[model samples]
Target chain A: SSHATGYNSNRILAPYSVYKGKAAFSLTPSLPTFTKLHSGAVVVDRRGSIMVIFMHAIGDRKYDWENRQRFALSATEVGSLLTMGPQDSCEFFHDPSIKSSNAGQVRKSLSIKPHANSNGYFMNLTVVNNLLNTKEFFSVPVTAAEFAVMKTACSFALPHIMGWDKMTHQQSTGGTVGLQS
Target chain B: SSHATGYNSNRILAPYSVYKGKAAFSLTPSLPTFTKLHSGAVVVDRRGSIMVIFMHAIGDRKYDWENRQRFALSATEVGSLLTMGPQDSCEFFHDPSIKSSNAGQVRKSLSIKPHANSNGYFMNLTVVNNLLNTKEFFSVPVTAAEFAVMKTACSFALPHIMGWDKMTHQQSTGGTVGLQS
Candidate 1:
């Protein structure tokens, strides 16, 4: 079926993917005076492959919610596989839109322990490391130089000038008001 | 200011960005019979530095909208830079969500002539070539192997598996009914 070959087939695990890994960092508050929710997981395949890791944070206001999803990879695994070179490092952030004043607020957070069980599967650092070290036919070696070029090109291609950092101050802090003609 | 250093600054030139290049390819219908709206632009700085290019597509239904924003770099520039090696080539598709049956329908498309005007800045083959070949302090050489690894890693990091390809057929085809629950 298409799932076997599709690059995005791994998304099938989204609903249950939340249970796969332990929290990589402590949850910290960013914007004060607002309710904040933080949740994250390191998803792995049935055979213990570390498919993805993501952290999401949301700041809740009376009328709107501010959210951010930070996605990343383990540097150790990436460095070993790609020979990323000493000078190479990478970081990515995507801020798509500004929340309108009338948008409703919803908050949900998941607490996953180091050995949480999901569908009878469990994951730990050893399992993740084993998966990373495994030699797969699909594994390819990438150089640091190539990564640098692509990064530069993408930066130039997607300029995030939406003033996301200043969003918290600009959002309406008062109760919602009905629209006036 | 951070805005000056930040890679993405709204570019305020979304309207003008379109004139910076030619249509890389014809806009062919992908999901037939459904209303399709496609918009694209190649954003550049006031000094004419190519910053980014983006295209958005939406398939409308009676109650909800199925939308996608596909971000890409110029193939001509990328292909020439890496030589792509023997095993390297890239294709991107974004399937965000399925359309609900009751979503409303709307369609619009933009026409970009080869030498359209944008704030008196017109881009053609020569302009693009000049931008790519310029000796910028930020320019870096990237290899094909590195690009492949980064691509594979990103796919696993962000999985958009909502069956957007099957959205056209599944959304509410009949009249909308009030929520029964």
Candidate 2:
């Protein structure tokens, strides 16, 4: 295929230029660069974006840290996590009939419960792939103190992005969420 | 508190009875009973509802099957699982500001990937409870043949409840999803 010259590529650009035949240079600003507020498998960045990491395991070999997986969460999702209960679980699924195989038949679920020794909690991850007959499993643990810190950091993080003033106020005052009835 | 007599319980029902003081009798039907299509950890029932079970473990003691947990899924959720890809993940979270603590601060996620040696796939489940500082993790595996059967059964199950004729037709003919672009 022959390449079209700038003049012939888009004849519509033939007018409104400072030069006779040159198109005006329009500079596109680069995307924003995010600074790290914290860095790890699970931490909230300065931009309030969160990253959660988990690992995969086979039948008897449960330690598969080499195959670490990371997922990002939005501000609202963080807020939801900060308020969820131990037994409550949520499901997310996409319409599988779409053309994109990657998005098809996808279902992801999450639930959390206490660590038996009362030391910490484990985050449960369940992944299923019907097309390939595959399922990946992971259990990531965070200590109780770590969870408290994460919750505090997350509350601050979301108000930075979502401007939930009431939430921030409640946290600052060390009061229960007044938004709840 | 004084108990109201049948005649006084509902003054609005004082009229249109077989007798002046007697109200017409009506029977309330019992709710439908569900028969088990298949029993055990994970199976679809005759009612088209699906049951998924996962066990919890504490620290190094991974075989905690005695504390097995069960979750029910609607027909549509089963269909979504049948078409999901190995890498795709979905999230479900509820609003935290709700008055009900049980329904608050909940986040659940599910994803899937292939098991080692191609024996099967592992379903990854992640559940978080920000309020209790707890999380639960579980990874369930299903062999390739089992997955295929589940997919077929799920495809049939949804159409039974959802009346998705196109989906059932495509599955019956062993045809690629005609609904896909």
Identify the candidate with maximal lDDT: 2
**Model 1 interface RMSD, in angstroms?**
15.7
Poorest 10 consecutive residues by lDDT, candidate 1 chain A: A26-35
lDDT of 1 at A96: 19
**lDDT tens per residue, model 1, A1-181:** 5323322232111111221122222111111111123433211111111123332222231211132222222223323323333333332222112274422222112211111221111111211112234311111122222333323322221111111222333234334533244
Query: Candidate 2: deviation at residue A23, Å?
Result: 44
Give fnat, all candidates.
0.00, 0.00
Q: Which consecutive 10 residues in model 2 chain A have the weakest lDDT in total?
A: A11-20
- Per-model CA lDDT versus the true structure: 0.23, 0.41
The superposed Cα distance between candidate 2 and the true structure at residue A82, in angstroms, equals 43
Q: Residue by residue across B5-124, what tens digits does model 2's lDDT show? A: 554564342111011111111111111122322221111223334545455544453444565444445433453455445443333233434577566575555545676766566665
Instruction: Give the Cα error of residue A108 in candidate 2, in Å.
Output: 38
Give per-model CA RMSD.
22.2, 29.1
> Tens-digit lDDT track for model 1 on B1-181?
8687765563333221221121221111111122222222111111111122232222231111122112223222222223333433333221122174422221112111111222121111211113234321111122334334433433322111211212211111211111011
Q: C-alpha displacement of A45 in model 1, angstroms?
A: 24
Give candidate 2 regions above 4 Å deviation.
Answer: A1-181, B1-48, B57-66, B85-101, B116-119, B160-181
